[model samples]
Target: MAKIAYILLCHKDPDAIISQAEQLTAAGDCMAIHFDARANAPDYVRIRSALKDNPNVTFAAKRIKCGWGEWSLVQATLNALQAAVAAFPRATHFYMLSGDCMAIKTAEYTHRFLDENDKDFIECHDFFESNWIKTGMKEDRLIYRHYFNERTQARRFYTSYELQKRFGLTRDIPEDLQVMIGSQWWCLRRRTIEMILDLLRQRRDVIQFFSTTWIPDETFFQTLVRHLIPKTEIENRTPTFLMFSDYGMPVTFYNDHYDMLLGQDYLFARKISPSAHDLKERLGVLYASEGVDFPISGEGRSLHAFLTGRGRVGRRFTQRFWEAGNTLGPERELFLIVCKKWHVAKRLVDQIALETDIPCVEYLFNEQETPLPDLGGIETTLTKRSRHRRSVVRMLFEYFGKDRLVLCLDPANLDVIEDFCGDTAKTRVLEIECEYSDDYLIGHARRVGLAGENSPSETVARLLPPIRNDLAHESELIRGAGIDGYQRIREAADRAENEAAITEFLGVDADKAQAVMRLDYLFSD
Candidate 1:
């Protein structure tokens, strides 16, 4: 078994830190913790008292006032890493982690996997060869000298930067020092940590240079590891998953994101919400378990498409449209069929799909969940995905092919119905304008087993309101789709005009739909 040492860098919430300390050290992996010097002393006191009884935990010797994009952050980490090394010299591997991070996999699995892989897991991209720092000043962060603290004294930091540029006070960085930058989180072999620490004792010039560079914590270990270690010995990936938002801020995980988190292959997840008690308690269970069952791979494409749009990058002009309107894929022909009677629309959809070469998908956004993609391998449920329905619909336009597809929808998806209606260029609305008796919905529900354990009257009562409300929008929906008039089929007395109108709108041969147009969808059985 591999003895692992964890370096925990924390700033706030003593209760959270204490709980995490207990859980992390549960498998006997020793931890060396460093509290930010600027945090409340009471918090540190509370944390120490809580974890003091645990043999696997230790505190760093020195605490420093750490700030964003400052050398003190690196100093604080160095303090913890050095302290952990001294306290647990037999530890085979050292992993860098933060207070908010929690293990997604079991400790036994992590230890066993690390024992097998001898290579270091850390991101170390060459600064000159890579476009690592994209947001702010690229290489200018290294070429300039930063004196005042960038976090607390922001005004002075900017003034000093401008002054250095005006006065030509830029310093020369050594050519031999291969400066690199990447994610701060990493896992390294004991030999790698010792070698870097030993070089830190000998290489004061390199340390002094990185001290003034912006966000050196992201660059310090990264640069040293790449420069010293052979490329074959590095994996160029972090053990901890730290996701960032578009604005360069950490994306925190919440209670609702449990299934999304578990589906991933990462060893640990970071920036977890402290208030997510359910997620926290569940994760605690998973962390202590002996074995894990990973879900079947490559399933949940429809579920994913429902939550997120089609996972494809659009071309230049379409890219802007995709971002602005939240639409994906090329323009395709979309036909929406709705009616006052649900079975009328459903019957037409089934017949069209059966008789013609065209694919007519029924009940797309209905409770039945169209085509019912196999979900035995998926963990997330439909209730959790209901919030993303519109996104699914918007992206579905692209997924349904660029030529044509006929679809059936209920009033529950009227918002999407209106969207399709608005895109008159490639979309057409076919509304069966007629007042059918309530018997159609009642019989159809019983035949399809939609009535479940309820009586037909009760099920129809439950399903009637949305249909009534949705059919009220017929004029607006058809008008938006550029359709001129209604195909009114009232009863057994009226069928000819409705059949002719449907045949003309569908552009199908009268011979194909002759029997389909004559049958009353309700009394056909």
Candidate 2:
């Protein structure tokens, strides 16, 4: 068996770390851990005691006093890596990981994947050229020097940068070195590790230089590897998958993210907190199921597809809109729903928003008092009419660009949405109809309290067809089941009013039951 060495950098949640180590450790493989020196003494003791019996697990002798975005982080990683290599000399590959990370694939599969792939697996890109941090924004970490603030225990101030500006103090890196940045976690071959260690001994200045740089843990190894190794020897990928929030922090996984995690191609996921114990337990159960393998190789366009297969109705619906919204694609889409009053389609809008990364906005034309749907903490943005038209349009174009799908929910507000989106070829108009002459439709609509002087059904039907014809070049018409549709939507909404009822009616996990209810409008259509 080919031995794999794991270097885990830990600070908190010692029990979680022990559990993660237990999952990954094998007879030949070893897990070398580096707990932050600043961590509580009790935590350190607990971690040591828990893993004391495991011969494959060893704690680093030299623990760095680690701080966020500081040189100390790089030090801690270096200590862990050196210790891992020293302890497991026969180890074929060295895998860097965080304490909070959990393997998505089985240990056997992970080992097989490492054995099959010859190239080093490290997420890398030129810091200057790539927008790895986020879309359209250049990273400032490379351009500026980040000095660690000992008092704050973080990189909150740039003391060196301030002094450099005032005193014109500058230190230039060697012209031969190219700056590279990426995720701190990686997997390196034994040869690669030896080469890295050799470089460290030969060029002491490289360490001195990167030690002062901002978030050097992300940049140091990448710069060294790119500088030393052939392009073909490196694969610019990491086995660990992390979802980052808008603010550039890793989005913590919870029970709600269980399905999402299973869908990803990566072997590991990070920052699985104590609150996510339920999700962790569920994943353990899932792994015990037959036919499951590591690296989860199969034919499907999405993670959702891989896990659930292509035939399930819910998966089909999610995949359809995900494709429509260009999920995990280069071209991101914004679904703009224009309305004067909250329509049933708002539920669909919210569903699409939750099920994908696409930004979905509901622009209420003149209804400033309209209540924004409680997204329950989904990052969907809802804008009222308080902002100026030009400002809002500019903002939309700035963020989502001209590539958008504009759904004209109310024909009366079509002009408003069009003006905001600046109607382009990327824009697709959609009209929804709700009217029916059938008595069942009328009676159900009245019984559900959706009928008025001008029923939602009649108003939508009267206003929609003309607009659909006008934008027929780039639009689709979605007709509801009149009163029957409203009745179904109301039923779902009533059940979804409470958490337990939603779970019972939708027959989905508690986290997704509400979302499933909101998607009732889509089913009714």
Q: For candidate 2, give the lDDT.
A: 0.59
Error of 1 at 196 (Å): 0.7
The lDDT values for all models are 0.70, 0.59
Pairs that collide, model 1: none
Error of 1 at 439 (Å): 30
Native-structure RMSD, model 1: 11.6
Q: Give the TM-score of candidate 2.
A: 0.59
lDDT accuracy of residue 262 in candidate 1:
57
Writing each residue's lDDT as its tens digit, candidate 1 over 228-332 gives 899999999887766665477787877865655555556788879989988888887777788776442221222233223322222222222333454323455
Tens-digit lDDT string for candidate 2 (391-439): 3433444455444432324544433434333322233333333333345
The per-candidate count of clashes, in order, stands at 0, 1
